[model samples]
Target chain A: MSVQERKQRERAERERLIVATARELAEQQGWDAVTTRRLAERIEYSQPVLYSHFRGKREIIGAVALQGATELAGALRAATVTADGPRARVAALARAYLDFAARNPAVYDAIFQLDGGLAYAQEDTPEPLKGAFAALQESLGEVAGNGVHAGLFTETFWAALHGLATLTRARRLPPEYIEQRVELLVDRLALV
Target chain B: MSVQERKQRERAERERLIVATARELAEQQGWDAVTTRRLAERIEYSQPVLYSHFRGKREIIGAVALQGATELAGALRAATVTADGPRARVAALARAYLDFAARNPAVYDAIFQLDGGLAYAQEDTPEPLKGAFAALQESLGEVAGNGVHAGLFTETFWAALHGLATLTRARRLPPEYIEQRVELLVDRLALV
Candidate 1:
C-alpha cells in the first residue's frame, strides 16, 4: 500500500476508537458526564486531536448512534431470519428490538432521545438507521395483512417495540409481564 | 368556613402552584433549568416553604408526574368516550395519547421518562397512573380480539402510542406519516 493509503487507514482506526470510547463513557456515566475533556483524557489523546476527529460532543454522539444503529440492525436480522414462521419471526423481532434497547441504553438514548445531529425518515437518513428499519420490515412484511402497506405496518410494529423497550427500561412496565406483552402483541397484531 | 378548613384548602392550593410552576419552568427551558432555587423564586415561596410542601426535586417531579397523569387520563377519556365505533375509539385514543405527549412535553417526560419516584405496573402503583391505564383500557378493551387479555393488550397498544409519541417527537419518524401511521395501527391491530 502507498504511504497516503496507510495514513488514511490509521485515521479511520482512530475514528472508530473515538466512537467506541464515547459510547463506553456514555454507558458508564450518563451523557452529562461525557464532556470532551473527559473523553480526550480517557482516549490518551490531546484535546486538539479529539477536536480534529469530531467537532464536539454532538458529533461524537452521532458516530455512536450510527454504530448502534448498525449493531441493532444486525441483531434484529439475526433474530428474525432463522425463525420458522411469520408469527415466530415477528415475535423474534420484537424481543430482539427490546433486548437491544435494554442492553445498550446509552446507545439507544443517542439514537432515540438525544440530539445526534442526524436526519431521519428522509432520503438522506443515515444508512445504519435505514438499514435497521429495513431489517424489521423484512420480517414484518409477511404478516402485514392484505391491503396494508408493508412500510406502514413495519413502522407501527417498530413503534410498539420501541414503546416496550423504553417503558420496560424505565421500569414503568413490570418485568414479569414482558413475555405476556410480546405474546399479546404477536397474537393480535401478526396476521400469521 | 372555619380557619382550620381554610388553612387546609390554602395548603392544597400551594401544592398545586408548586407543581404548575415546575412544569412551566421545565417546559420553557427543559428539565435541567427547573432547579429548586428557580422554583422557589417562581412560586414566591421561601425555600423552607417549598421544602415544607415536598421533600425536594424528586418529590416535586413526582407531584408533576401525578398531575400530568390525571390530566392525560382526562384527555384520553374525553377523546374515546364519544367516538362512534371500537376502531374509531382506539384511533381517537392513540391521537389523544400522542397529542398529550406533544402538547405537554415536560409533563409527559416527568410521567414517562424522568425520575418521578412514582410506582407503576404494581398493586401499590399511584392512583393517577392507574386511572390513566384504565382510560386506555376502557376503549382498548372493546377491540382486544377474542380470548386475548385486555390488560396485556392495552399495555401493548399503549406501548405503540408511546413509541409513536417518542419517535415522532424525536423526529425519527417523519411528521407527514403521522396520520397514516395512526390509521394503520387502528385498522390492522384493532379487532374491529
Candidate 2:
C-alpha cells in the first residue's frame, strides 16, 4: 500500500481508539466524570490530539452513541433470530434490550439523554441509528400483520422497551419483577 | 401576625420566588441557561440571597423536580378520574404523560434525567415523588388482576410510558404516531 493510504488508516485507528477510551471512561465513572483532559491523560495523548479526533465532548458522545447503536442492533438481531416463536422472539428482544440498557447505562444515556448533537429522525441521521431501527422493524415484522407498517409497530414496541429500561435503571421499579414484566409486555403486544 | 412571624413568612415567600423564577428561566431557555448568577439577575435579587434560598443550582433543580412531580401526579389523577374502562383510562394516562413531558421538557428532565439528589423507591423518598407513583398505581389497580400486585403492574406500565416520552422527546420516534403507540400500549397491557 502507498504511504498516504497507510497514514489515513492510522488516523482512523487513532480516532477509534479515542472513542473507545472515552466510552470506557464514561462507563467506569458516569459521563459527568469523563473530561477531555482526563481522557487525554488516560489515553496517554495530548489534549490537542484528542481534539483533532473529536470537536469536543459532545462529538465524542456522538461517536460512542454510534458504537452503541451498532451493538444494540446486533443484540436485537441475535435475540430475535435465536428465539423459537413470535411471542418468544418478542420476549427475547425485550429482555435483550433491557439487558443492554442495564449493562451500558452510560452508552444508553449518550444516545437517549445527552445532547450529543446527533441528528435523529431526519435525512441527516447517521447510518448506525438507521441500522438499529431497521433491526427492530425486521424483528417486529415477524408478528406484525402484512397491512400494518412494521416500522410503526417497531417504534411503538421500542417505546415500551425504553420505558421499562429507563424506569428500572432509575430504580422506580423492583428489579426482581423485570422478567415477569417483559413476559407480560411480549404476551400483550405479540398475542394480539 | 406578629412582626417576627411576618418577617419569617416573608423570607419563606422570597425563597419560593427564587425557585419559581429559576424554574421559569429553565423552561424558557433550557437547563443549560439557568445558572445561579443568571437566576439572581432575573429575580432582581443578590447572588447571596439566591444562595440562601437554594444552596446551589442543584437544590434549585430539586425544588423544580418536586413541583414537576406534583403537577405530574395531578395530571395522572385527572386522566384516571375522567376515563371509564381500564383500557381507556390507561390510554388517557399515557397521553397525559407524554403531553406533560412534551410541554415541560426542562421540568421533566429535572425530575427524570438530572441527578438532583432526590431519593427514589425508598420510604424516605420525597412526598411528591411517592405521591406521583401512588397516583399511577391507583389508576393501574383497575386493570391489574385481583391477585396481582398493583405496584408491580404500575411500574411496568410506567416504564413503557417513560420510554415513550423520553424517546419521543429525543426524536427517536415520529411525533405523528404518538397517539397510536399509546393506544397500542394501553390495549396490550389492559387486556386480560
lDDT of 1 by residue, A24-102 (tens): 9989997888988898898888888888988778888999999999999999999988999999999998888888898
The deviation in Å at residue A190 for candidate 2 is 1.4
Task: Please state the Cα-based DockQ of model 2 relative to the true two-chain complex.
Answer: 0.73
Q: Counting only residues 3 or more apart in sequence or on different chains, how many pairs clash (N, Cα, C under 3 Å) in candidate 2?
A: 2
What lDDT tens digits, residue by residue, belong to model 2 across residues A1-192? 699999999999989988999899999999989998999898888899987887888999999999999999999998889888877787788888889999999999888777788998888899999988888777687776555567777887888888888877876665788888887777667653
* Alpha-carbon runs more than 4 Å astray in model 1: A1-12, A32-37, A45-49, B1-14, B44-52
- Highest-DockQ candidate: 2
lDDT of 1 at B5: 100
Q: How accurate is candidate 1 locally (lDDT)?
A: 0.89
Give the TM-score comparing model 1 with the true structure, all chains together: 0.88
Top TM-score prediction, candidate number: 2
In TM-score terms, candidate 2 sits at 0.94
